[model samples]
Target: MNSLENFSKWLQEEGRSSGTIKTYLQIESFQKWWVAEKIADRFEPEEVTVLDLQDYKQFLVQHARNKRGGRLAAATVNKLLQVIRTYFKFLIETGVISYNPALKIKNQKIQKSHNTVRWLEDKEKIRLLRKINNPEGMKNTWHYKRNKAMVYTFLMGGLRVSELAGLIIPDLGLAKRRLTVHNGKGGKERDIPINDDLFQALSEWMEIRKESPDEIVFLSQKKGKFTLQGIEHVISKLGEQLGLEDFTPHVLRHTFCHDLIIKGYALQVVAELAGHEDLNTTRIYTMPGERETKKAVNSLSMGDSF
Candidate 1:
């Protein structure tokens, strides 16, 4: 009944994020298995059984190590499961699936034992910038300058890698202390303010940003468009070299949002600047640390020691 296409259409109509829609449609891995199992021939959604889903889950755990050289993480598996469950739920509501087979599937519990901030601290950020500016431990070359600018923009601007990659010179508002982010997550446009630090970095970069046929703000060594993967690779290598192993562009984004909250900025203001779809997402960054909570509780006055 072409349910997949119909489901995709529904997602688009519901204003789902482009990333979510894309992931749902990229179900080729599941489809390949279905085809080999002979279930791809005019498969009826209502005809599926719980046992069928169980078998597929097992197959994922057993044979899907080809990608990561190990079984997929529970979080990854759960994401795929959520998409299938939602698809079937949609089918049932639309009179496609008379019964839902994925109803019993449970989401995996994510381990949060680390309980550490996902973003960089102010001092670590300074170290990060220092490393990017002179990776060779000497002489800031042209590439080092560009690397510093790119990293600073992600940290201060809080842009998604894709958004950064798509940026052009025309989106800048250097004179006004902000930049217009075009085609961000969920196809939303946002204006993000840049502080004096970020402004100085960009000023240096613009001198060598180099006028060319490509209007993209960032460029690669090959004279082609900058790519998400390329930017990630640069950040990853810089982080490792600077002794901050898990650093990433998104970490910089998280740090940007976190710093705003710590600096006494209103939650709504941070939400708007970060372009979060929900205020609840912004609230997550404000969660008190264990140490902070302990200190608060201990501040109470006890009149007499028992």
Candidate 2:
């Protein structure tokens, strides 16, 4: 069997979704590099080694061109490396290779500031809520109410847009004021409790949302299941309306975790709520906002403050 087919079977056996399998397959730069560099004279999995993986990482940094006419972003490069790492791990398990050479290859370092993620300031959040509560047009439309609930879920529940899109009717635990995120990153599932405001918003939206044949909780303009991009665009529009610069799903999620940390929530709690597999991932959200950072510096008396 071909390598792709073999990898596909292994990923499926490991419970990766079909979409994930397709994405992994598309991350083909490593194979291209192996062939082009004459590392093995031909693309053979068993013959690959750590030195080859190391060289390919350098190639990605210096030679790879992104679609926008720039070097690959650190995050993108790291994602590609992750795919290579996983593929080699699969090969090792299958005995295709004696050992996994990609195991020790380090990912590219990405500065959190370079990520361009920002959350709403307290005033901005208040302004957004006020706008949701007092819409000038459509005082009674489901679309307006649905958007309000969605926005609250993103901020308060710290849900990713893809997770929100995957929700079903049963995922909402209204009586208990919690929602089950069944499609979190890496297919991990977690339950997050809703704040009173979010509970009320969701409750009101559910009352107005027209029932459809599909079990999906969120719906699009045509009443079909909501798509991931649709949720992103909704937040983008809200950001534009609120004068939030470069607003997106990650920003809302980061804002959620940031607010929690500043409010004295424990790291473990925040990590669980955010559905982060690693506390290190959650720690990135703790990076201080400009206002908070400035306040911290000012709070410390300068040297020789007798």
Candidate 1's displacement at residue 204, Å, is 3.1
Off by over 4 Å in 1: 1-20, 28-41, 49-66, 85-106, 114-117, 129-141, 265-271, 275-284, 287-306
Using all chains and alpha carbons, the TM-scores for the candidates as numbered come to: 0.70, 0.90
**For model 1, where is the 10-residue window of minimal lDDT?**
108-117
Error of 2 at 45 (Å): 0.8
lDDT for 150 (candidate 1): 84
The top-ranked prediction according to TM-score is 2
Give the alpha carbon lDDT tens digit for every residue of 86-111 in model 1: 77777787887688989987766655
lDDT of 1 at 91: 77
Q: Write the per-residue lDDT of candidate 2 for residues 1-306, one digit (tens) a residue.
A: 888899999998887776678778854667877887884566888777789889988988888899888999898888889899889888888988887888799999987671455777788878877887886876558789889888888888999888888889899999988899988777678999888989988998888884667788788988898878888998899889889887888788888998998898989999999988789777876777776677788889676686
